[model samples]
Target: MQWIHNYQLFLFDFDGLLVNTEEIHYLAYKTMCANRGINFNWDFETYCRIAHYKSEGLSQKIYAEFPELYAVEPSWEVLYGEKKKAIIELVSNGAVQLMPGVSSLLSALQKANIPRSVVTHSPVELVSAIRSQHSILNTIPYWITREQYSHPKPNSECYLKAIQLLAKPEDKVIGFEDTPRGLTALLGTKAKAVLVCQIEYPEIPAFIERGVIYIKSLDDLANTQL
Candidate 1:
């Protein structure tokens, strides 16, 4: 079996890994659709497929295909900004909870004096809002969000920025993610990534084929001595 090194830094993805907010994001998009007189619902499978695309570009592509729904919009950016704010409010309500084993794992990491950071495709404002609302204050020593880079996830830019911010080599870092796109971003970081399978994503054989180590929960970190 493969092994995780002791005393390594961690880079985490926020949406699915740190909190169960991916569906909240989809609900926020549905709320945005209310403004346009169209009811949009994104299933788990559909959201996963589209989330692999660049963040802002993903929203634009979805919006473009439904021009009839958003015909009255003055600008795409304005619409996107509004939708993102809606999402921030949804998350700020604390309706979404942290995933199982997250707090305990993070607590253990903190007690061990491991440096940790977040590497996410989420916009900086939304990421900060969620973090602050959830009171996840001191777990991260460094944070890298999409706003810090011109390129978004599924690209290596975010992860590269985390490594630079933490001043750690790839081999000395570890990453966690639940989605294929997030995994792609983590793998692009050149760090060993632990693939935490979500209930919505049960049969991800492709992830294993990509050399990702699959775990049922973040508690696996303790077993791996991370």
Candidate 2:
């Protein structure tokens, strides 16, 4: 909690860090496979492991490792598109929920007037969808979404651009991410990077080896009056 105050500018990764959309995303991905008659019955635990795989060094990454998809669709983009569609539908049904302490953390940040922005690869439509249901999210003044950047996570381009726009030369910057892909990118900024997730992804231990700070949730921020 005290560490958060060390930074004057704060950046956050969306989807996992600020919200509990991982479960919704897992459901949406599973639904996409089911709709196409692909029996993608990986339980939540299995889906989480695969979903957290970094798409950084790879192109056209297929989230589902099923052969059934190649037969039904030529492009993996279409699968992701369908997955996005399902996610929006589920979100429309009030499926998305804010992660614990997100509201209090954002409120405290706003109260302190520390400059903050959400740097995410998520589309603006999905961000807006969540905001519609959780108005507390509106406390974030800037959202650097997919449309604003070309390169994604595991590349610092997105975060670099956000820092350039939001940080002053004298301000210490800190960023929060839920996975190694996003955390890798945040580390590139030379800002203090924090990993926040309770899920035990196999990929995470390698990061822990490198001394990445990990937290189960942002609930500690709720204790910060800012």
On lDDT, the leading prediction is 2
Per-model TM values vs. the true structure: 0.82, 0.88
TM-score of 2: 0.88
Which segments of model 2 are wrong by more than 4 Å? 1-4, 56-65, 203-211, 221-226
lDDT of 2 by residue, 1-226 (tens): 4555778888999988888787888888779888988877678766555566566322133433566677778776777788889998999999888898888788888888788999998889889989999988898898999999888778899999988998888889888998777888888886777788777766677776866667778885544333
Q: Each model's C-alpha lDDT?
A: 0.72, 0.80
Model 2 score (lDDT) = 0.80
Candidate 1 whole-model C-alpha lDDT, 0 to 1: 0.72
RMSD for all candidates, in order, please: 3.4, 2.9
Tens-place lDDT per residue, model 1, 62-154, is 676677665777476877777787887787777678888887777766667778888777777777777776665457777777778877667
Candidate 1: segments with Cα more than 4 A from true spot: 1-7, 54-57, 64-67, 167-171, 199-203, 219-226
